[model samples]
Target chain A: MSNADHHLVAGAEGHQPSLAHHFSSHRQQYEAGKLGMWLFLLTEVLLFGGLFCAYAVFRANRPEIFIWAHQFLDKQLGALNTAVLITSSFTMALAVRCAQWDQRRLSAFFLTLTLVCACVFLGVKYVEYKHKWEEGLLWVRQFQPAEAAASLDESGTSDQQPRHAGIFFSIYFAMTGLHAVHVLAGMGAIGWVLVRTLRGHFNRQYFGPVDYVGLYWHLVDLIWIYLFPLFYLIH
Target chain B: MKPGPSSGTNLTHHNDQPFHAHVVPVIVLLAVFGALLGLTFLSLAATWIDLGTWNLWLAMGIATVKAALVALYFMHLRYDHSFYALVLAAALLFVLLFVCLTLLDTVEYYPDIHAIS
Candidate 1:
C-alpha cells in the first residue's frame, strides 16, 4: 500500500522461522497438527478393537467361566485405580492449558502429577498381576480360579484347580497389558514434554506438542475406562 | 495441495483464553469419576445375582459410559473441533461392525463353538 506499510509487511514475512514455505500463516499449522493427531488416534482405536473382539468372543463362548473368573477379582481395588487414571487424565489436560498460557512451572508440575498418577495405576496393576502370578493364576500353566476364589489369600491358591481359567487371564493380560504398554509410552512422552516445557519450548502459539500428547494420554485413559469394568468388574 | 497455507497461521485467534470456564471441567471430571466408581461397585454387586447373561452387557454398558466421559472432557474433545469427534465415531462404528461380523462367523472358525454354546 504505502512505502512504510510495504516495508513492515516485508520485514514480518522475513522474520519468523516458524513460518512454513507453503503456508500463509500460523493458524494452518495448528489445525494440521490437530488433524494429524486425530489420524493417529484412529489407529489406536483399531489396536484396541482387536483385543475387544477376542474378549467378546471368549466371553460369549464361556459365560459361566467368565463369571467364575470375575468372582476372584477385588472390585474395590479396580474402582480406586479407575479414579486414579481419571484424575491423571484431568491433570494432563490442565498441563496443556498451562502450557498454552506460557506458565512453565505450573505446566511442569501438572505433568509430574499426571506421571505420578500413571505410576500409581501401574503400581496397582503390578500388585494385582503379581498376586495372580504368584498364585499360579496366569494363562497357560496353573490358572485355578476356584482356588483363587477360595484362597482370598496367597496360600489358598493351593487347592481347587480349574486350569481352563487360563482363558480369562489370557484375555485379561492381553487387553490390560497392551493398555499398560501405552501408558508407559505415554509417560515417556509426557516426561519429554515436561522437559521441553521447562526449557520454554511452548508458548501460547506453539504448545501443539504438549496439547497433542495430552490428547493422546487421555485416549489411553479412555481405553482403561472401558478395560477396568470389562476385565476386573465383569458381572 | 489441500488449500492455501498451513493450518495454524490461517486462524486469527489461536484460542489464547483459558480452555474451560472456571473450574467447570474439573467439577465435571470428578463427577464422572464418582459415577464410574459407582457403576464399578454396582457391577460387582450384580455379578453375584447371576443375571444369567445380562451381566456382561450391563457391565459393558457402564464401561462405555465411563469411556465416553473420558473421551469428552478429559481429552478435551468436547471443547475441541467437531471433526475429531466425527472421526472417532467413524472408527468406533467400524470397530463395531468388525466385532459383530467376527462374532457371527465365529462358529466357523472354532468348530468346538457349538459344543460350548
Candidate 2:
C-alpha cells in the first residue's frame, strides 16, 4: 500500500506512540480492549450467578436454616468490610480518573490507598474466618457448631437448631471464598498498575490498562454489595 | 489526530470527539460514593424494622441500587458505549433466565423428593 493508504489503514488520525501496530487508533484500541473486558466481566457475573442460584434454592427450601445460620455471621464486621470495599472502589475510581487526566502521582496515591483497603478487607476476613474456625463453623463435612450452639443457647434464642444448618456454612464459605480470591487477584492487578503508574507508563493517550483494571476492581466491589446483604444481613 | 483535553463534564460525548478520554468530575464521584454509603446504611437499617418478607425484598432492592451505582459511574458504563451496557444487560438477562428455570424445576420436584424421603 502507498504511504497515504498506509496512513489510512493505520488510522486516518495520526499514529499514537503507545497504539498497538495492529490497531488503527488509540480510540479503536481502547474500545476493543474495553469490549473484551466487559465480555470477561459478563462471564464473571455468570460464574457468581450460579452460586447465587444455589443460595436461592437452598434458602427457599429451608428458610429457617438461613435465618438461624446467618446469626453466626457478625453483622458489624460484614458492615465494616462493606464500608472498606466501597471506599476502595471510590479510591480506585479516583485512580482511574487521575490516570485519565495524566496525573501520575495522584493516580499512584489513590492506587496505594485502594491497595491498603484491600489489605484491610483481607485482614478483617482473616479475623472472621479465624473465629469461624475456632467455633468449627465450616462446610458440611467439617462443620462442628458445638461452641456456636452453646453461645446461641446462652443468648436464649436456641429453638432447636435447624436441620442441616451446615448447608448454610457450605454456601457461605463457597461464595465468600470465591469473592476473597477475586479480591486477592484484584490486589495483584492494582499493584501491577500501581507500579506502571509509578514508572510513568500511562498517559491520557493510553490509560486503558488502568481503566480496565478499575472496571475489574469495581466489579469485585459490586459482587460484595449483593453478598453482604444475602449472607450477613438476611433477616 | 491528537487526543484533545477533557471537557470536564460528567458525561463527555465520546462520539463527538473519540480521541479524548472522559474525565468524570470529582464531585460526581464523591456524590456517587456518598449515595452508595447512604444506601448501605439504609439496607442495614431496614433489618431493624420487621417488614415480613418485604424485608428481604427491600434489602435486595437497595443492594441492586448500590450495584447499579457502582456499575454505572465507578465502572463508567454510563459514559461508555451503549454496547457495553447491552452486553451487561444480556448477561444479566441470561442469569435471570438460568436462575428462574432452575428454581422452577427445583420447586416442581420438591414434593417428589420429600415423599421419597
Candidate 3:
C-alpha cells in the first residue's frame, strides 16, 4: 500500500537482481518502465501527426492530384506490405507473451520471425522504390513521369498529367519514406531483443524490454495502417 | 502473499503478488489478429464500390478499427493501467486539434490563393 510496505515486501521475497535501486519492487520498476515507454510512444504519435496534418492540407486543396497520383502507386504491393507488417506485429506480440510466460526459446523464435517479416517488408519496398525511380516517378523537382512528360511536350496540353503532379509524389515519398525508416529502426530494436532473449536475459519477471519494443513495433504498423489507404487505395 | 491472478486493483505497485504481467491468452490474440486481417480486406473491398466522398471516410473508418485493435490487444493497453490509455488519448486529441485548426486556416485563405494561381 505504501512505499515502505512495498520495500518490506520486496525484501521479504528476496529482491530481484533486475530490480533497479530507485524502485521499491519489481512491479514498481516494471510499471515505471512501461509508463516511460508509453510516454515515449506518445511523442512518436505527435511526431507522425505533423506529417499526417500536412498530408490532409495538401489533399484538401488539390483533390485532383491525389486522385490522379494514387494510380501510379501499386495497390498490390501496398496490400502485400500491409499484410506483412500486420503479421510482424502479431509475431512481436507473441514474442512478448512468450517472454511473459518465460518461454525463452519460443520468444526468440517469434522475434526472429518478426525480424524476417520486417526484412520482407523492406524488400518489397525496395522493389517498389526501384520501379518508381526507373520510371522517373520521384518527388518534386525530380518528378518526371516518363510517358506523361513525352506526351505533354508533343501536345502542349496533357490531361494525362495534371499540373503540379510533383507535389503528389513529394508527399508520397515523404510519408512512405519516413514510414520505411521507422521499419528499419524497428528491425534493429527487434534484433537486439532477439539477441537478449537468446542470451536468457528475459523471464516472466523481466520482459519489460520485449514489451516496450512490441509497443513501438505496433505503432509502426499503426502508422502504415493509415498510410496504406491514404496513399495506395485512394479512389 | 503468493503469486496468483492479479486482483485488478493497485495501479502503482502489486506488492501482494510475486510477479504481475498479463499474459494474453493465445485464443484472444488469434481472434484479434483475425479480426484485424478481416477488416483490412474489407477496407480494400470497399474501394470497389463507388461512394465518392464516402469512400475516403469508409476506408479511414476501417483503418481506425484496425488501429484500435492493435492498440487495445496487441499493445495490452486494455489490460494495462488506465493512465497509459489516457496518455495516448491526449496525444490523439492534440493531433485532431492541430489538423482541424490548420485546415480551417487553409480553407479560409484558399480564395486568395486560388485567384493568384
lDDT for each residue of candidate 1 in A1-235, tens digit (9 for 90 to 100): 3355435544555555554555443444555877899889999999899999998888776666676676556787887888788788878877876776778999999999999999999999999988888766777455654455666545653334343667988888888899999999999999999999988877655677888898899899888878877877665
Highest lDDT against the true fold, candidate: 2
Q: Give candidate 3's error at residue A80 in angstroms.
A: 1.0
Candidate 2, residue A117: how far the Cα is off, in Å? 0.4
Give model 2's share of reference contacts: 0.62
Candidate 1 displacement at residue A6 in angstroms: 17
Per-model TM-score versus the true fold: 0.81, 0.92, 0.92
lDDT preference between candidates 1 and 3, better one: 3
lDDT of 3 by residue, B1-117 (tens): 222234134323443332566777889899998998888889888989999999999999999999999999999887776778899999999999999999999999999999999
Q: Order candidates by lDDT, high to low.
A: 2, 3, 1
DockQ each candidate and list the results.
0.42, 0.47, 0.50
lDDT per residue, candidate 3, A1-235, as tens digits?
5566766758854656676778666676777888898899999899999999999999999988888778777888888899999999999999898888788999999999999999999999999989889878898899978774675557754346677988988988898899899999999999999999999888666789999999999999999999999998898
DockQ leaderboard ranking: 3, 2, 1
Model 1: CA > 4 A from native: A1-14, A17-22, A141-163, B1-52, B107-112, B115-117
Q: Any runs in candidate 3 off by more than 4 Å, and if so which?
A: A1-5, A13-15, A148-159, B1-18
lDDT values of the candidates? Answer: 0.74, 0.87, 0.85
Q: After superposition, how far is residue A101 of candidate 1 from its true place, in Å?
A: 1.7
| Tens-digit per-residue lDDT, A37-133, candidate 2 | 9999999999999999999999888899999899888888998999999999999999998898788999999999999999999999999999999
